[model samples]
Target: MSKMDKKRMKYAAKPGLMAALDIGSSKIACLIAQPFEDGTIEVVGVGHQVSKGMRSGNIVDMTALELGVSATIEAAEQLAKENVRDVVLCTAGGAPESKLIAFDVAIAGHEIGDGDLRRALDPTWLYARQNEDRRIIQTLPVGFSINGTPVRDPRRLYGEKLGVNMHVITQASSAVRNLESCAARCQLDIESHVVAPYAAGLATLVEDEKNLGCICIDMGGGTTSIAVFKEGEVIYTAVIPLGGNHVTNDIARGLSTPVSHAERMKTLYGGCFVTGSDSHETIKVPLIGEDDSEENQVPRATLADIIRSRIDEIFEMIAQNIKDSGVDPNIGRVVLTGGASQLAGVRRCAADILARQVRRGRPAALRGLPEAATGPSFSAAVGLLHYALAERQQTSFTSLYSKEMPSSRFGRIGQWLRDNI
Candidate 1:
């Protein structure tokens, strides 16, 4: 064989590599991993950078965001000693919305098959077309029924009708396009796009929590994303525009300190609840735009009060959003993951407000994962890696419907039958 051809063969024999980029309001993280035969992943490289030109998970400065993304990707590639062309990305912006869509196809007493499942799911394409301004990012089949009787796997079941309840997640087209544009500038092709909260839940929630019912809340710098899981699938997802940054801003304004100092103070001394020691403990707050020698001594209780008010407000909104989602707020425990979840007393405050069992969540340990990256701040990024791998094992109806379908309606049906039968 030619030398170039021999090199290609050698490279092809190696296991494929996967990369995931988590773009958040406050930070950007990249991970590169290789999957093993034992259903585990070994992370080879990791990189993170302070986010720029992004606000509330939306790109506001394309050039700045592009630079940040490129740097982060380069750092990861350098560490792994491998370059990747494609990456799976997760987003917390774009005003993501979720709806449960029911679709059915007439079976006429025939046994349900893959073609029948495809037919049942085809209508979601029409639904997407009807909503021109939004793009469907995820389509999860929560359940299937044959002739109105639910079945775990409808294939091969005899029924006159086959139906599916699809949990469809969509984001504004502008938001999705902006993200795509930024990634394109970074010379990266998006393998898939996942919602931030869904990715967080996948990384942090245990199997029982997902199978029973659980809420995963990922608190980032500028947005708090939420995912509700039931029956081992994500049934609902949401993003709130308030996050850790808001708390920092509150501290800055209340203490008249620079944003940097305010963030430091919140990280070191802030708490959602005040203790008796708070009255005795004091923090030195530097006045904004002032010399280091000019500062005010403030009791810890003052900082705690400011942090408590904002944290309480956030949890209250979370509580109300859960109630509005129509899911049983009491159904399962709550898992809190993300940077803001690490603050003192946040978990207890969430439990008190939501009236559910709440626990701080971190990503599952992976091979070669660094100690610093094991915290809640990195949960979404780690979850993106998990989602990218798991996604390959499952079929994405949305992809088939939107990208792979034939132009002609009859041609689509024929192709589906040809593939399935």
Candidate 2:
């Protein structure tokens, strides 16, 4: 074989199956990825189940939660026809908390390189990581100033002192409990747990949006999560415990229908921003234990208004979060995603409420993705891979073995050491 062919083979050695689990309030999705010999990712397994035992992103019942997780995993395993070992999960619990902490350190008169910045921030991370009842999922660098000038990388620049603004997204203890117990029951291992908004942003937001300024709002079944990025750094994040489920409940109660039927009507006919002439048409919604012909006919505009009311409340809450974080001053655009985001007019409604330029956001991008994942709904699952790849790249660049699984799986030597030593 030629040298290039041999090099390609060497790179293909570590290509293994990576799975994504999006356990939301409304649904649970499992997507397993396999890297082909030609370096393409093929979706070998897919499983999705209606979520249960979760309330607004928190696990309220463990027994039901375990059964649900196991069932989903079993289906995915059956589809993949393999017993997968590791999976990455998404958590919107308690709305992953975001706090900005700044640290100023003297560089001892040395020019700051990537190593220098890392050295200076190591203690800051230790401080944040220590003495907390929470788990830190993402420690994103919002920005840095060397001396008096702002810098993006801030590495290899001369400076007497380096100051950094870091945003830490944290998960609550209950989140850990629900995910851990459920995964244990399912006999699956969680490689990492990431904030839903952050992961979703990774899948949907473009590089320019991150580098410039953009906000990612993930409207899921249980909660609405917001992550703000400036210059490609997440500056703020917050979770609101209201999602599409609330809308379904409202419809169920307001229209006197079952929750299941209400959900069906919502997905098939839900809209946040109603247009003119909505009253000219009517939709047939089945009541509890009723035939189709006996269904209730209601103005489509009324349903849109109901969906909008709850969605408005959710957006108003998120707006306050961004303002409170002092991130809106820098944000220039917005991206919306999640299961609830699939609703008609959601993008438009969000834009009107936030009063900013808005667009539907999907998962940002992946190395080897296909058309199956093109929808806006798959943002979180696709983003998990991006987050892992970014983390891997950072670690691998810092290590002596720069080429060993820098963007995906680690080499055997590294994995062995991580597991054993």
Per-residue lDDT of 1-421 in model 1, one digit per residue for the tens? 5432232233222237888899999999999998877778899889899999789887899888888888888777767877776788897999888877677878899877677676677643544253446666666778888889988778788988878888877777678778877887676777777899999998999999999999999999999989999888899999998999999999999999999999999998888877876778888999998999999999998898899999899889988888888877567999999999999999999989989899999999999888878999899889988876775544434433434432211112211111111
Worst lDDT run of 10 residues, candidate 2, spans: 412-421
lDDT of model number 2:
0.70
lDDT score for residue 72 of model 2: 72
Instruction: Give a tens-digit lDDT track for model 2, residues 136-179.
Output: 55455567888767877677777787887766555664466557
TM-score of 2: 0.82
- Candidate 2 — which residues are off by over 4 angstroms? 1-16, 34-42, 78-82, 111-115, 123-133, 289-293, 364-373, 395-421
* Steric collisions counted per model: 0, 8
Would you estimate the TM-scores of all the predictions? 0.89, 0.82
Q: Which window of 10 residues has the lowest lDDT sum in candidate 1?
A: 412-421
